[model samples]
Target: MMEKHVQEFAFMKCLPALTLAAAMATVGTMIPVASQADTSPHSGPAQATASTQYPVPTFEGEWAIMAMDPVKVAGNRALGPAARLLVTLPDSLQKIVGQNHFSLSRQSGSAWQGKQDDLTVTFKLVSENSAELHISGKENHKLDLPLYRNN
Candidate 1:
């Protein structure tokens, strides 16, 4: 009787191992062949497609000036100040803004340029939401202002 009981216990233990092995085999065979297809050749265009997720900036509404620092001239004179700008991205435009549409070019490093009528402004980022704005080339002459996002 003891021998029969020992055999039954061994069989029960083996049942769990058999079940586990069968489960693994089932899962291994279930893998979709399409998922394992060579994706490397298609990866470059896929990455390029992902980059297009961001949209470009356009002239639509009000964007604020964040910061402004003078860009030193060759002879210690101040040709202009660096500036940064921010625009409260409208719900309609948020998707495009994610691609860095509000960003502009400046005469110096990391500085952005803005224009209003006859005025052209230069700016640099002090933070993600703030910038230093330098306004010139108009009757306003020169102005430094802090621009902030609405939300």
Candidate 2:
């Protein structure tokens, strides 16, 4: 019984300190990290980095992967050459590429290229409506997909 009383006394004395520490932690989280980070101007080239702009291709936009079986589209012989080419792409090229996003840094008429994360992304406009999306990633993994202009 006496040990219990001593234990309670110790806890009572520590409670205020624990509450203060918890309150400090709460206040720390309430403050935005951006407001706390040092924003003062540095003495060197780091400031110039803010102005370095990445070139954006004029055709930078999302494209979709076209799932086509040449045998299915075979019946539609009347399809235009460009449309036909998109549909008849070899199975060797068919791929399930996630996120049909394109941000080509460089462009030349129908061709475009850009680096997205670790993947090299490229596209070729087949028509005003259709495009080809190609992404090459680490270990030479490549993806070829058909796309339709989303906008």
Judging by TM-score against the true structure, name the best candidate.
2
Span of 10 residues, lowest total lDDT, candidate 2: 70-79
lDDT of 1: 0.44
Across 1-151, the per-residue lDDT of candidate 2 in tens digits comes to 9999999999999999999999999999998776455556863222212233322232334444445432111112232222211122334343444443334433444555667567776656565556566678888988776666455
Could you estimate the TM-score for every candidate? 0.28, 0.34
Clashes of 2: 0
Please provide, for model 1 over 1-151, each residue's C-alpha lDDT reduced to its tens digit, 9 standing for 90 to 100: 9999999999999999999999999998998655564567644222112122211121212344234222221111222343233433334333422322233333433355656555565655444444455556555566566555334
